[model samples]
Target: MERNLELTIRMDNDHVEIDVYEPESGECSQIDAPLSFDEHPEFDAAVGNEIYSWLSLWADELAGQN
Candidate 1:
């Protein structure tokens, strides 16, 4: 089964921001870091995975609670 989640990424001059949204409950979470992709080309993918992992854990926790 799939959870109703949305992930958005935003990049600016100084930082990169990631927003995770759960439409079911109208809840959201954010993660951000300095824009250092010049030094770490894989940063975007890494952050994406981290966000996905976090959402999965959060869903599991909510399921357990229910």
Candidate 2:
């Protein structure tokens, strides 16, 4: 089944966090080394490249909001 993903991002001056959740199925992928989003390859590529990609992507988004 194709479900819309929900991302919860929390960050501060010293830390960055990205979390993925498929609410319908309750599958969650949190901020951890080698973050896994196998069930959802879309995000697997978005934030899969270590913490670099994860923070980079969201950092861009957050910056744009300002």
Candidate 3:
């Protein structure tokens, strides 16, 4: 089956944020927002195995840190 997901990554001066959205059910929740690559390498490893792995593919573009 094919599915669509809305993933958001936000960063403030001192905060890093990540939100996951499920359009089918209109449900949303906070996952994890690792501030820097060095801050949360674990989040990176965990997300790599997820369906939203594509989110990481665009991390540079979205995070504006690359």
Candidate 4:
């Protein structure tokens, strides 16, 4: 099934921002307000199943937080 969700991300020297969009029925709703990531932690590695596992957990946590 096709998800109605879309993610847009932007980053600069100062901060990072994420926007989630939902489009349906000739209308679009910005489901999530843009979030700033100024205090985000650093990740040294990005490879393999570990990344997938982390993302899955992160997604769940983020959902709950929101």
Candidate 5:
């Protein structure tokens, strides 16, 4: 079986929100926090790494179930 995963990122002046959706199972996960862009130049890369880690862990758990 194949699993479908979707990721969405939304940012505003005060914070950044990251949402993960598994459409096949209607499971959703999110990560959000206050961000100061001027203070942290590595914000984008850091957040990207976090999301990738979440996806990898989710995938591994799903694979183990099968």
Candidate 6:
């Protein structure tokens, strides 16, 4: 199986939007929550292992930071 995800981020002076879109499944997940600036490390030890680990979500965390 092949996984294809399209990421789109839009930010302004007030807010940041992170979107992960999977064209194969027609699924889009908006996965960023509000937290303290200090807690926003962008990448975590779980590396997308919150439920089931997948490399793409890990990439998402990384891409959002860059």
Best by lDDT: 1
Give the distance in Å from residue 19's predicted Cα in candidate 1 to where it truly belongs: 1.2
TM-score, per-candidate, Cα-based: 0.53, 0.44, 0.53, 0.32, 0.47, 0.48
Which number leads on TM-score? 3
Residue 25 lDDT in candidate 5: 67
Write model 1 residue lDDT over 1-66, tens digit each, in one string. Answer: 456678899998988887878787788777777788468555676667866786787789889988
1 versus 4: better TM-score goes to: 1
Candidate 5 stretches greater than 4 Å from native:
36-66
- Show the lowest summed lDDT stretch of 10 residues, model 5: 37-46
Q: What is the number of backbone collisions in each predicted candidate, taken in the order shown?
A: 0, 0, 0, 0, 0, 0
CA deviation > 4 Å runs, candidate 6: 33-39, 42-66
| lDDT values for all models | 0.76, 0.59, 0.64, 0.43, 0.74, 0.57
lDDT of 4 at 19: 48
TM-score of model 3 vs. true structure: 0.53
Q: What is candidate 5's lDDT per residue for 1-66, written digit by digit as tens?
A: 445668898999888887878786687777676777567656666668766876787789888999
Poorest stretch of ten by lDDT in candidate 1: 37-46
lDDT of 2: 0.59
Tell me, what's the RMSD of every candidate? 4.1, 13.9, 11.2, 10.8, 4.3, 9.9
Error of 1 at 29 (Å): 0.6
Query: Model 2, range 1-66, lDDT digits (tens) per residue?
Result: 123568888766544477877666586777633334345464455565544644565577678989
Per-residue lDDT, model 2, residue 27, is 66
Cα lDDT of candidate 3 equals: 0.64
At residue 59, candidate 4 shows an lDDT of 77
lDDT of 3 by residue, 2-66 (tens): 46778898887756666777787686766565566556676776555554554554464467754
Q: Estimate the TM-score for candidate 5.
A: 0.47
